[model samples]
Target: MKVLVTGGSGFIASWIRKELLARGHSMLVFDHQDRRQQLADGEEFFLGDVRDATAVTEAAAHCDGIIHLAAVLGTQETISNPRPSAETNILGSLNVFEAAAQYNLPTVYAGVGNHAFRLIGTGCYTITKSAAEDLARMYNLYRDGGRITIVRPVNAYGPGQSVAAPYGTSKVRKIAPSFACRALAGAPIEVYGDGTQISDCVYVADVATAFVNALEYTAVHGPTERPVEVGPIESVTVNDIARLVAEQAAILTGREPVAITHLPMRPGEIPNAVVTSDTSTLKQIGLDAIDFVPLDEGIRRTVDYYAQTWLPGYLAA
Candidate 1:
């Protein structure tokens, strides 16, 4: 089967591409070569932008299906430069759906929790993603052959991530990075608001597997997997993620954590939102969270990855 993956050069998209290829599926990538070419090698991608209808159509022309993971990422990042965010995340998705609708193809639409559900104070990223998901669903309503599945992941974390987005750099690094960076700073972790706000987090590999599984399921059956939310064994709190990170860091360095506190909650944040899709439905469709990675192990792996690859030399030292 030939598969088209938009934003194929980014963290999640790259992993999704590899997973697709590993399954022996021919792959084409629909992402702008906007300095992201560094992440791709020769003979790997089709080289196009999702915003360009002509490019997107050509890329999707011969593909069996598409795993739509291309989008502007990170909360603060989207809010900072909403122009590109809107163009790529929202309009780009529109182009994909339009192209798929014309070709009458099957697609798995990837979105985040905040983006799909309208959490308070959500940024343009979520807004666009939410719109895109709806557009995909609407396309399903009109086209008999177009199958659309929506999967909303909450702040996916782990190796191969590039975390310097506005969200991370602006000192609002979601739950995971906020904790890991604090631990690296030898400062106690801090939770915004009461720390009771909850969200899902999944390892990148697990999420990648989920994407492929979703694509396969849609291929086998019709895309009825609306509201697809895959997470770890449990839903966790902000404090839970923080404590876990601090605990893991202590074991890694043999030092006690300093201070863990709570600050003001970011405006429009979801007070409590933990979306866990019914594995039974996924199972029925030949998909399962059978490879769910434990949070502790995932966190340890993520911390090490950031420490080694992303963090500056000074930060590591």
Candidate 2:
């Protein structure tokens, strides 16, 4: 199978590309930025924005299937600027669906499991993502019969993840990398609002595997009633994640474990987040979470990766 992955340079997308390639699928990447990473032999790259229908259509012309992952990330970034987030996340998704519809191609898109239910607040990211999911459903309704599989994954964190987006000298923070950075620097790991908010953190490898399986399932059986939810079954609280990162970072960097401190929770933040996926359905599709990386082990690996690969260079600069 030949696959086109949007946002192929992103954290999880990179893993998905490798996993798909390992499965003997030809791959093409369509992304806004110049290819920051080297491509595997026989893999191809195209520079384009998902917001452009012409670019998306041309990119999908030679591919048998599509894994749509391009979007503006980060809660704060989306919340701070809703317009661009909506334009890219929601509108960009419509463009993909349109292209897929035109080519009569199967598509497996990235969705957030949290957006499936009514949460405390609908932040810009969730709003746009949910809208995109709806658009996928609409495409299924009206398009000329193409398989549209939606995979709503939990928080995906691993090596090659970004802690901050570099713009000039300022930085926009992300959760896992932020905690890893503080742990490496011997600073306190800050937990918001007493640190009891639960999050389902799934390793990138597991998430990528689920996505590949989803694409395969779509190719065989077509679309299903609901989006296939994929992630670890167990949930970890924010405080526990911080402590684990500190412990792992201390071991990797030869520094003392940092204290876990509390700050006031940000506005529109949910008190607790518990992610649940349809495991029976996932099993039917041949995806099992039994082999998933445990939270502690995943944190250890992530911290070690950041400490050895990123922190030293960051400190020197």
Candidate 3:
């Protein structure tokens, strides 16, 4: 099958592209930026934006299905600049759904698990993502619309995640990359609030597998009635994550554990946020046999990636 992957150059989409290629599928990658130096054998990159309906429609042609991953990410970034986020997350998603309906394709949408905790977060990212999910549900109701399956993933983290700006292009501050980079640099790890806030961190590879599984299921069984939740059932506190990163970095770099400093919670972020999910839907989609990467191991790999790829450049400068 040939798949149209919006945001194909992104962190998660990079894994999805690999998964697709491994499963004997071809990809038509559509993104505004041209990030690839060389395309994989079965992959084709198209320079376009999801916000451009014509571009999206043009890219959807000749594809068997769509995996819509384009969006304005980062809670703090979106809160500070909600207009662009809304335009991209909401309007851009609408374009993708419409294009899918027009092409009669199966679509797997990337949604945030934080949508379930909207009242707690109340941020622009959550609001826009929630709207996009609603659009998916609405589009699925069309009799002639493409089969649309929504996969709601919790905090996705692993290697390849960009560190916060000045070092990377990502405007959002993700926990794993932030902590791992700081710990490796021997800088203090900053924890928001009292560090009791809970997050369910899923490895990027596992999240990619869940997405491919969801896409395959939708291809065969049509749109699922409920959003398929992706992540481990277990949860970890922010402080726990910080300490874990510190420990992993200490082991890798032969440095003492870094201090974890508590700061005021940022705008559009939830305090003490806990993620609760029902992953029976994942089982229903034939992901029952999969084992999630343990948090400790995931962090170890993440810290190691940064220590090799990102740390040298960071430390030298």
Measured over all alpha carbons after superposition, the RMSD of each candidate to the real structure, in angstroms, is 3.2, 2.1, 1.4
Q: Which stretches of candidate 3 lie over 4 Å from their true place?
A: none
Query: In angstroms, how far off is 313's CA in candidate 1?
Result: 1.6
lDDT of 1 by residue, 191-301 (tens): 777877776688777778878878888788868645677665567787778888887777665789657888876644555654444445455445566667888889999
Go through the candidates in order and give the clash count of each: 4, 0, 0
Tens digit of per-residue lDDT, candidate 3, span 148-232: 9998888889999888865666677888999998898888999989999888788899889888888888888898878888887
Q: 50-134, model 2: which lDDT tens digit per residue?
A: 9998999999898999999998875656677789879999999989998888888889999986784434675688888888988
**TM-score on alpha carbons, each prediction:** 0.85, 0.94, 0.96
Q: What does candidate 1 score in Cα RMSD to the true structure?
A: 3.2
Better of 1 and 3 by TM-score: 3
Q: Pick the candidate with the highest TM-score.
A: 3
**Model 3 residue pairs with clashes:** none
lDDT of 1 at 21: 68
Quote the positional error of residue 115 for candidate 2 in Å: 0.6
Clashes of 2: 0
What is the TM-score of candidate 1? 0.85
